[model samples]
Target chain A: MKRNNDNIKYDSKVISIRNLKKAFDDFEVLKGVDVDLYQGENLVVLGRSGTGKSVLIKIISGLLRADEGTVNVLGQEITNITIKNLDRLRLKIGFSFQNSALYDSMTVKENLEFPLRRHVKNLSTKEVNQNIEMILEAVGLSQAINQMPSELSGGQRKRIGIARTLILKPEIMLYDEPTAGLDPITCIDINNLINEVQERFHTSAIIITHDLTCAKATGDRVVMLLDGRFKYEGTFEDVFKQTDDEMVQRFHDYNFIE
Target chain B: MKEKTKSKFFLSKKIDKVFIKLNDIWLFVFRFFKEVFVPPYEFKEIVNQCFELGVRSLPLISLTGFIIGIVFTNQSRPSLESFGATSWLPALMSIAIIRAMAPLVTALIASGRVASKIGAEIGSMKVSEQIEALEVSAINPFKYLVVSRIVATTLMVPALTLYTALVALLGAFVNVYQFEGTSFTSFFVQVFEAITFLDVFSSVIKSFIFGFTIGVVGCYKGYTSSRGTEGVGKAANTSVVTAMFLIFIEELLSLQIINALRIVD
Candidate 1:
């Protein structure tokens, strides 16, 4: 598989999350989870609902603090960084929200411009508009620029979310439930867009979703979460050939329904 | 025998849920302070929120101000006339308004309208996981959400109070003429003679504080909201009530301070 970043060697790792733990009250959601995201690779985190999949990704992105352990992203230790430094680190990573958390009151243009305006310094208004137009076209949302988020469909909203993330042009992208609420055709559309983003922008991505089609289409590696730990982590073939795991077999079997 | 066990199990589960929710809210509050100054400032979003939360809510504040001014004038006119102090209407009314009524009443209305609206909007966003989405994006939710809201309230509330005072004075003018056939210039002369600069300045400054308190407390409660729809309702309800209480307390404290200054003089 061609990696997203040509500047870095395929074997080099970009994100190293070691022994991460997070607990809400008495219930521990993640118990010593460790994962490494290689340069340019699309890693799909698959899990049942409430199995801490979102929490795991959140810790890596510096959104949620891990109860213990380390998250080193792009060679920086995120856990111990100062507030100012942490923000600088964040600008290098883009996140597409699960429910397309576009600012409801903002127009599509404003949503796309939100990060670009904040992080990009000395950028002319013309340059900003060009970037927005390019990202919007990439997400197939040129027509929806003036529209409010409430005016978009579920799939269109997700694409806008993706567009918003891409406007930052970060080294890494985190997608939380990017295809959760879309139809199959729409899911395919999103999957194609994700692949296109990886191919064109060469940005490393980690998608958190249980959609098997999404796993097969966009993921270079599938990591399943069960009981707050990774049950399986491997390529699609590695998962498909295995007969020992019932959940893997069930997912593989269900893939034929399409 | 099994029935008793089941009921006890359900009771324990309910209690456990409440404790966990309370725990989450406490943790979020602690986290809010920690993340407040972190960079990647959500400038565009904050400005947009300010326009929504502050500017858009101005109409309601003005309406309340207008009504209060008219009602105060109408009610106080006959009583002052009995003491042959009818000409003191503008002075007395202006003092009543600039000193106490405008800020007090505007804050109370804002507690009902803007505070509750903020609570429900933020509460819904929290439950829907939008706030979590913001966090995972490496954005500091506290600075993005709370600070923007507080700043908006601090700026808007005083402006709203000022507008309310102006509108109310106009309403008082209408009331005076309708009742006593007094011209507008005479009313102003009487009002100007009665109301000290201290009264206007004190009232305006107090309204600013009231605005800040309402916005901060309303956003705080909403940001920490839990328990689904029921929690959202509770947050909105408490935001208004707390703001109303704070406005009253602030007014009383300012009054005491003013009295102290008068006594010293």
Candidate 2:
């Protein structure tokens, strides 16, 4: 399942976080974390639940601001930027939430169109329709376009959620547990979709998951987060096999069982 | 001394919670005002919410208004009869409905329906990360969700209040005709003569405040909801209760302001 990233281009750093520190009161979720996400590469941030995987991505996307350190996302330090300015920067970053986070009030088509209509306000009706149609087809959920989020299954919802983000045509995608709560087949399908998204769109992504299979399938380069810092960094096999630490092995085995 | 200190400590904790809540509300309202006038106004969303909060609540408002009017008319008949003021029935009822009962009834009903609906809807959206989804999309969730609902309620309450005044008048007329054989035109003529422009204006202004109160309380509760799924239920419950509580406070304040303004006039 390890897709070769030998040919994947890394023209520039899409995201570079140096000494990123975020905490909730005394709980230091991400402490002095440093990471880089390069262009046209699917960088998987692997960690167990509550291991700051989601928090890292949230900071990258500016959903949650880092308490300390510089998070340079697409060349802007998010911590120093105002919300109005950050929103402009956020249009370039697509964040798919752990629960898919589709607007329950809206149908799938509306959910997809939500981002498009907001960011690209001047698109013609024809162009809007084309974009919706194209993105829905890309996610392979064109049939479920009119259905509400509640009507779709977990996998379908995740697909539509990715489609919604894709409609914005972001330069970077941040998938937060895109395969968190799905069956093995659905997980594989999501993993394949993540890879296809990179291949087709030629976009950089930071896929956060504890699922080893997902990381191997989607990630071009993998990093394992332990104690709020990456303990292993390399290809999935290199990181997993090259590590001699018992904690890293235990985490890997634990992740495999889960 | 120890018991007194403990009591004081608990009291201080309660006060601290209130102060923190007040600060949050101040910021929330501040943000609401800031976003409301900003560009990219969600007019379509505001209109849709108005349709949902306004047009959808009309039948219920009308029914409640009518029943209130009939019951009030029946209850006041004996008192007026004893005083030889039975002829003043239409005028008295119209005055009371326009001034007090109509807006109060409409807002109370809406607090149950609209406030709880807004609370639960937004609370669920918050828990489900739909609000964050909008934020990540560069669409302001506060502007789209909170402002739109607030604008809808602010507008719809007054409109519903106006409609209730008319419906309640009709109900009062039906009762008057059934009991005392008054004609439709006669009852309306008496009602209209008794209701001044100030009465109409005050009712409208009061309803607007009631609507705003309901909207703000509902949005505040729902937006700041915690405890996940359980939070959503608590949000709906608290929204209804808080909105109703604030509505009464607003009603009293509006009444006092109106009385002061009348004296000035």
Candidate 3:
């Protein structure tokens, strides 16, 4: 596997998880999982449905606390930090949920401007409008600025979700199933956009998805989560070569190569 | 023996459930106070909620108040005439409308309208993960969603009650003129004589308490909503029911306080 060393430096761990475990009621979702993310690297977590991929990201972002062990994000342990400090740390991390989760009450412009107006106060109207235009342009949705989330198509909503997160200029990005319910073409478009975002912003990202196209298109390294832990870790080529595990082999076989 | 054990288990479970609910509401109220006084007040959301809870509710409350005044006056007229105290009609009607009917009716109406709406909106937001989105953005969802809503209801309910009182008195005047040929001037004179500072103050205080109850209960139900789309409906239903119950409890307490203070005859 070829490593991109351009943005790497000493102390390259942007996020580190050690023996993380989480359970909902009696169901154990994550049982002693461990992972690390380096600076400016796109790490894709591949898992089937209900394998705790989204849970892992939520734990890292402090949206959900782990049952045991530790999650270190940006050199701060998130498991035991105060809510005020967690909120402060959250500003540096942008999370795009699976459903795009746009504020249905607001127009696209308002939704995109929400984070900017909240975090960066005293910004002039001109600056706010400029930032909104720039981010919408990046996502190719400048025309839909005045539209509401309900008015947008599924793919458009996803792009708008990505645009809203990107407007914050976060150092770390966590995308949970960014292309879960889109057409193949739209999925490809989103995958390409993900790669472009990583390259342009130099952000370290952890993309949680089961889509092989997305993983191949954007991931520098891939990890397959199974039975509450990372069962496989390698490049896309290395993962495809593994046939010993039935689940991993099924994932490989299910992908329609173009 | 098995039946006895089962009954005991059920009773304990019921008690535990009630205590859990009380604890949840208490914590929700604490969080509201803590977040409401903090910085970054959501002024725009508060204004929006005021518009929704106050302005939008005017027509329904006005109609309800008018009907209540007409019915109440018509019902009380025969009894007063039997005692040769027909002149006391306006005063009795005014006191009833101002002290109890206006606040209780307006609160129940708002509990059905505003409380249900807040519960459903917030519950749907939770179901769709919009609340989580707000949290991930580092914005305080409780302050933005709950505090502004509670503050708006707390302020607007009294305003609505005052408006209801005016409309109800007007209805009473119309009803009186139809039956007894009492002039508007005489009727209003009797009403003004009957009303006191204590009556208005007590009514306003009760409305404020009822409004706070509706807001807090609605927000609590919605904030803790789970189980997907079905949960949204359940939250809306439970919010209205719980808020109306609390309004009655507040009314009872207010009456006791008024009697203690000799504010009512």
Candidate 4:
């Protein structure tokens, strides 16, 4: 566990998840998980499937409650607050899901405009439309604005999801398996886009992934989750430089297979 | 010894099941308020949901209500004639329609049609991680799905009940005029005179509770529903059954409560 008491200077640390514990009928998924996210940095949480990586991020976003824990984001304690306050806190953090999670009933443009129209206050219709177009262009999907999510390819849908997250201009972004189902080239493109977004907006990000390639490329710092606890925590280079750990060695060896 | 162990195991398992169900109920009640008053209502998806859930359900509800009115009147007429109370048919049928039949029948239709639709839609959304996606997007799922549905049901079910009552009277009138020289104006006078505010109030209040129950049960089942298409089917089935049962119980209870309160007053 890393202590942040001495290093606390910035008022906006993006997110702090402390002692999160979640369970489903005695399954006990997350066990006392603690993490801190800072501004303008990409932190990738790498783990096997069903290892509580996504659960950690979900707790921070207030999607799922920590059975017993405190989640502080942008200086607000989310666990004890009312839902209205939670929503207010969430406006500062945007999220892109694994499957794109685009509204099947809506066109890509409508999906992009959903949060904007809901949360953004006092924006005229013209302004909302303009913002939509701006975000669509940023994600390089202005041409596919009218197309339904079903009509788009996997990569295009992913890009549209990214566009929807970015439209709110959030200070913090959470990505759950952003590059999971895409091709290698598309994965690289998404990683580059994430980096570009970080530089442009100075936004902090928490990326949940099992793909080491994605973790190394997108992560400024990386943490490895195993058996409901973080087994490794450091920069990408620090994690890759080791050979003693069996899982890391295996992951490294598998990357060389093709 | 084996018998004792077996009984103990069964008892503990039953207790565990009760505990879990109670937990789910409590969580949903907590989430109900949490989502309703929460900011950022997810207006776009909710509009889409209302169109899909409320507007699309109108056709089925109207069709069912119309059929129920026609058939129920046609069936009850011959039986009334046997008892020499054929002329009492107008008042009798009106009392029936205005008190219990209209609301209960409409609710059954809603349970089968609207409740199942809401349950299946939300269930599949849950299975596919769409609900989780909404939460991650900072959108409250309960407000987005449940409140919009409750509001829609609140508005539409009363309108549907009124439609059922009207159609039922029309069907009874048609049945009545087909045989004897029973005047339409006379039938209207008898039926309208027989209806007190108590009858009308009870039926309307019952339908409102039925609608609210359907919305709450359907949303609860679907939201807590597990993964896969099987889970979706289970949610839809359970929601319809739960809503139907609750509506019946509410009708019985509300009638008794109304009568008791009237007596006291």
Candidate 5:
């Protein structure tokens, strides 16, 4: 597997996870995993199902505590930070869940409005509406402003989820399986959207996905997580060249077959 | 010897599980109180929850109250008539309804309806990672979701109980007029004479306690739910069961305290 060469230099580290370990019951999900996220880079963590990709991002976000090791997000050690500080840090990080996770009781407009109203309390109705309009237009779902999550299709729901997270203009974005369970065309659309978001917002992101196409489209660096630690870290082209590795070969063969 | 060891191990595991659950719920309660008093109170959410808990529950509460009143009067009438104490019907029925039946019945209904609703809603959110989404968005789910529902239930349950008592008394009036041709005015007077400030106060207190219990248990079950969709269903079911159990326990304790206080007086 390819590794990061010493020739490259990152501008500044936005997130640094060192010797992270997490276990539920007797099952260890992350075993001394370490990674660094630099500014304005999309670091795609590509792993097969059940590889604890989501767990790693959750630990970085401070949603789940690590049993061992330290996670520094925006230069703040998340493990020891107070809840108030964690919350302030969270306001700068947006998470787009795989299932969209929209409030089922609310309309699309209300779902988009929720974060703004909570964090940016002084925003007036007109400003909020304009913000919502801009995001909905960016996601190309301005027509669905009044619709409920249940009424929307899978692709629409994913777009709305992205829109909701982007409304706050978070400095860091964590997307958990952004294109999972979608048709090939829809998957491409979501991948393109991810690229567009990266360019538009200039936000560093950690995208957890098994889709190689997504990694190629959005990742400046693709890291393959295997056995609870990163086994490969390089460009998407470097990943394609590592066909001698069994797991990487298998992933390429399976994904490239179509 | 091996069998005995196995049994002991299982017993200890069960005990550990119960204690862990107790500790989790206790911590949840403390966190709720702490967050409730913090700044940025969610008045809009609370108002919305109140409307849902109080206004939407009116029909069911009214129906249960009326039926309970009629059934209770019918059941108690022959016994009173046998003792030639038919004239004491309104007083006895009012005392029973105000002191125990109304609060207990209303709480049970609220537990079934509101607790299950809260549990299912929050559990589904937990399953779908919406709670985590809120956390990531800098929104305090406990304050926005749990506290609002708890406060709403606390305020609305007593209001519902009062309405239930009134409907029950009206139902009792219907039964009384049908049997003895007694005027509504006399039945009202009799009921008012029997119901003291203590009865009203105790019923309100019990309802408040029941409401708080329902809110807390429901939110706890939902917030901690695991195993995905099936866990949501389990959370809803367990919420109703636990809320009902707690309501009965609260009622029993309140009754004992009221009796002890009366004896002292």
Candidate 6:
């Protein structure tokens, strides 16, 4: 492990996975992978497209099940958990999808209210409105409360999506490609938002991305997934330090854009 | 012999895939039934979907139903004249519209219009990861998305059919009054006297079946749709096609059952 950062928080593992195996029929996406997410730390999982970065987070969130290993998330084994139990566990996890995944039919306020309405069922209308208002302000989109998803730009949509996730005040956040197809400045803003979310929400996170800049800006520790396993684990520089490996050098070539 | 075996194997594989998909759809429906009766009934969503699938569809239903009445009345008017029974026009047109045409036309339109809408809406939601977002939020996406629409369709289709029946009858009456100058009261009296209770009941029942088919097939296609634009397109297309096909099948089966019931009654 590379401890390049001066301040590295090492709390007890919020997510613990060991020998995780997942396959789609004949194609094995996650072949015996192991990792851990510490409390209040940002762990970046770097991989090219189809390297199962999304699969890993999906397993952690109990959205997808592992075929042949243990995925213990929030102190519960997710693979064999009941639906009701999994749902209870999911309340503690907030997943920010790559596409933002805001309900196109709903306005920003409705999108944010959906989770709170479900989980925090006892909140009065006034309280619900307050929560939505607070979340929108927190994401710096207070003016976008009445806006439909179609009216918003990609970055705005992403912010609303994050706000929606954060409304529940989850203990763990899972960001899947927070800045995949954005301009560099927007990417930086999203990266800053990730850091802000961790700091402000007091939540651990696993950010799955292929962007090296994002890895540097947000990741307290970086893990490079190659061919369904973590090939590099450490700081951003440490991941690319061993240039002798042809695959790592190639991945570095792709992500380290000028 | 090897080539023959390989071909047979491929066919078997295809059949197995279809069966697997069918099984999954059945399980999805069963799960929907299980979840629908559980607590926190999602009353608001159900009402929202009812408004979407029911009340919002009235104008289209009225237009199609009116046209069906006009076309059927105009085409069949001369035939009754050929039989020297022009007085039977109101009775025959009313019976046809109330029993067969209204249910079929309304269902076909519902299958074409509403099923595709549902499939595309849910398909887009599925592909865009909106459904999973709901799941992550601990919300029952099936209950919110599927059950609400199904219940709305099941209730509203029959209601729409009745509305169609009225509009269609008004259309037929216009044709009758123009050609023969029959009074409105007499025409309605003849219409009511000609049709039995079983006919109206059967038409409502068939409409209900059509509604259920539209809801189930549309939701299944959408919820199980693959990712991407192509998948969404396929889901919408298959939703309309499958619902229409099932509607026709149900129409035949229902007519047969109703005919048997007519004999008993």
Best by lDDT: 3
Tens-digit lDDT string for candidate 2 (B1-265): 0111232454579787898789999999898889899988899999999999999998898899899989999999999999999999999999999999999999999999999999999999999998888888888889999999999999999999999989998899999999999999999999999988889999999999899989998899999998899999999999999999988988899899989988988
Tens digits of lDDT, candidate 1, A1-258: 232334434687889888877788667888888888987889888887898998877777777787788889999998787767877777778888888888876799988786787668899999999999999999888999999999999999999988887888888989988889789999989988998898888888899988888887888887888788776788866766654778767766766534
Q: Model 4 scores what on Cα lDDT? A: 0.79
By lDDT, the candidates rank as 3, 5, 2, 6, 1, 4
Residues A1-258 of candidate 6 have per-residue lDDT tens digits of: 122333335767889999998887667888899999888889999988999999899888877777888988888988889989999999899999999999999888888887787788679999999999888888889999999999999999899989989998999999999998899899888888888888778888999998988988999889989888887888778778855788778877877556
In the range B105-193, model 4's lDDT, one tens digit per residue, is 88888889889988988898898777876776667677887778866776667767877888778777877777655898998998999
Question: What TM-score number comes out for model 3?
Answer: 0.93
Q: Model 1: number of clashes? A: 0
Superposed model 5: Cα runs more than 4 Å off: A1-9, B1-11
Q: Whole-model lDDT, candidate 6?
A: 0.88
* DockQ of all models, two decimals each: 0.29, 0.48, 0.43, 0.28, 0.50, 0.51
- Find the 10 residues in a row with the least total lDDT in model 1 chain A: A1-10
* Candidate 6: residue B88 Cα off by (Å): 1.8
- Model 1 DockQ reads 0.29
Which residue pairs show collisions in model 3?
none
Q: Which digits, one per residue and each the tens of the lDDT, describe model 4 over residues A1-258?
A: 121123223455778877878876657777888888877778899888888888788778877777887788888897787877887777788788888878777798888777887778799999999998988877777899899999999889888888888888888889999898889889888887787777666688999998877877778788888777776788877876753688876766676323
Best by TM-score: 2
- Candidate 2 chain B: minimum summed lDDT over ten consecutive residues — where? B1-10
- lDDT (tens digit, per residue) of candidate 3 on B1-265: 0111232454579797898778888999998988888888899989999999899999999899999999999999999999988778999999999999999999999999999999999999999999999999998899999999999999999999999999999999989999889999999999989998889999999898999998998898899999999999999999999999989988999899998887435
Docking class of 4: acceptable
What ranges in model 6 sit over 4 Å off? A1-11, B1-11
Residues A206-234, candidate 5: write the lDDT tens digits.
99999887887778899999998888788
Docking class of 6: medium
Error of 6 at B126 (Å): 1.4
Q: State the C-alpha lDDT per candidate.
A: 0.80, 0.89, 0.90, 0.79, 0.89, 0.88
- The alpha-carbon RMSD values of the candidates against the true structure, listed in the order shown, are 5.4, 3.9, 4.1, 5.8, 4.4, 3.8
| Sliding window of 10 residues with minimal summed lDDT for model 6 chain B | B1-10
Candidate 1 vs candidate 5, lDDT winner: 5
Clashes counted in candidate 2 amount to 0
Structural similarity to truth (TM-score) of each candidate: 0.86, 0.95, 0.93, 0.84, 0.93, 0.94
Error of 2 at A215 (Å): 1.0
Report the Cα interface RMSD of each model, rounded to 1 decimal.
Answer: 10.1, 10.1, 9.6, 9.8, 9.0, 9.0
